[model samples]
Target: MTVAPHPALSANLATPTQAPAQRDDAPIELSTLRLPTPPVPPDTCVIDVAQLFLDANYAGLLSLPIVAADGAPVGMISRYELMRVFLQPYGRELFGRRPISVLMNHAPLVLSVETSIGDAARAIAQHIRSPITDDFVLVENGRYVGTALVLDVLRAVEGRLADRSTELERAYVRLKSSQAQLVQSEKMASLGQMVAGLVHEINTPLGYVRNNVEMTRGVLADASQLIVAQQAALDALLGGDVVADAQARLDEVETLRLRVDPAALDDTAALLDDTLHGVGQIGDLVINLKDFSRLDQAGAQKADLNHLVASALKIANHILRKRGIEVVHQPGELPPVECAPAQINQVLLNLLTNAAQAIEHERGRIVVATRAVEGRAMVLIQDNGKGIAAENQARIFDPFFTTKPVGEGTGMGLAISRQIIEQHGGAIRMTSSVGQGTRFVVVLPLRAVVREAA
Candidate 1:
């Protein structure tokens, strides 16, 4: 996910340097250099630096930079504050060619390094907004500390998530030993839960096996002897000359059948059979669960792409239930692909979720199709949603950027997805237009079987 392009700021991103300063009691005027600067493009505002100020805003450098005591900047200011001035005509003219001293908003909202991000976000919402023209500034004691640009806020939130992907990528490298330990830990936890369920699952079958054995022993010991007696009588009748003997033998066999109690035997067999069938179902469930959560699949392996997709679809079936999103798969019994199955699953999840969210009014449809291309396995996920705008297509993978409303997403999904796919020796490409829809194509190497043959 990428952060939306800010209206006030240019495409360039700037990283401010931290410097030392002496404390001053009287208000110190901020200059243009201390304002929000992008590291991407380093150029002074050529027209009038005043244009950098939000529309009609009184604030100079409309960006409030966090400064060390010596008046060196540690952080920049807020655009929302600059916007307040844009509403007035004088604020617009006042911004023109004016010295930052006369125009800069003196009181910058500041925060400490230890401050929780939640508190920082709240501070920005409450005190630092425009009219007040302050934002949560990073402060260490009485000195300026670090800065959290609005563009970088979400990126900062996922502080721990950085290593998560790095671990997955260079997983076999020497440095990945710690990452392997983490994956091992994950495996152990998953195995523990699986073991518990399996024990409960096996217990039912064991209990019935005990009951079945007891019933089978009783039937063979008691009822079987009676059947033998009836057979003996029938043999004697057949050997005799008298019709009365044959009638008596037939009656004897009927007597044994009547004494056996057929209902009990039927009940025992049914219970044992049902228990066996249930055990089979439980084993199947365990296998699917294990397959879904396996972490070692980080290494690329030759496997069935269609089978993997189908399994992942089954696992994610619950997510699609309430969204009115239908997933259609045009999968053939495809050749194996050299890929990391888990990463592929993660990519599919992101695409599927995005497809579901893209729908506006009525139903939405996503088609996942597979085919062969060159020496690769070609997978396409197509969605009928609001679609991507031309302006935003290139920036879609920038971290912390999101098109969705505030609080709905952190915007790391696609960026991470692309990285993961690329690490597995694959490429992900997308195509979309405003009114139409979006299609994501994932291309991976064909199975080694096919490659070797070539």
Candidate 2:
């Protein structure tokens, strides 16, 4: 195949960038950047150079290659030097009859097709004996294939650099945006888990509060009737003899006691205490949720794994209680972990909620345990629910892979959980057998190095 010179070659050859033509194996090869080689037969005359130039259709080209009979580059000839020689007195007559090889550069700049532009430019710059305008021969497998100009290589490098800069800028913008979205996604998922248990948790205490208030109202009414009875007795005493009405008043008081029910009044203090305790329980859930969904605390910090589990449990209690699932916490003494507390809380909550949702029947039991092992903190959450099938277990961590009915799950819980845990220098894995149970083990380092952005 005959390769032609670029149409803009003439314009660029005059003011080429000061780049060398040293050969190198880089990503961008000279083969893709080289122009067609301007060649002449070994026997071609110096006077025939004009016809050679016209044949190649590169009038502005300053250098041309002299090829041997076998098409190997023998040397190069420069238009500037050629014109100088011909301008001498009888110079054309003296040399025009001889082959161009007599005056051609025998050791011109040469580069391989595989040469990288940087190395090529460096090589060209190092060849101080040769002019910058000299076109370097591009050879492949020891045969002349094409030629390259420094200007073309520099232009290619500049364009490539510009494209790379744009690409990096786009990637950076996407990273920042994704980080923001990830934080919001975690918050929403945490909120969703908390909301699942919210109705039952709030209703339980609210029901008790209503019952206690009703009972207290009845107690107040009974007390009011007793006060009226005592007042009537006082009126009788003030208007008549005290001793006479004392016995009657005492009888009325006895009747009033019967109506008031002394046992009920005795229980008032305990009933109020129970109501107060119920309200406090509801309040605790709210606070736990608030701490669990700490979206603003995105930075890493020292945290206790046990406390994170406890907070997650509190947030997921409504789900556990609703399903009659018993949670047994067996926490071992552990050191604090350096991580993002809120994200860790989010991970724990996801595991607990998933355990609750996996239960197909009542009496489901979830066991959450934490321990320190080999300078690492491990959290084990096991559930005696309908365990995952072997085929489906592997895909549970994949995004949008959920067994829940439509709209009941976004399938992002485990996926996001894994991301958060891994970002904290931790790992989460699960083991399950269908109809038996499922166990999730999360291992985290006590002190974690901050993760770099992808």
Q: What local lDDT does model 2 show for residue 348? A: 87
Ten contiguous residues minimizing lDDT sum, candidate 1: 38-47
lDDT of 1 by residue, 317-360 (tens): 54454466788999964677877776676667667667667767
Most TM-score-accurate candidate: 2
lDDT of each: 0.58, 0.79
All candidates: CA RMSD in angstroms?
Answer: 21.4, 8.8
The lDDT, on a scale of 0 to 1, for candidate 2 is 0.79
- Per-residue lDDT of 231 in model 2: 84
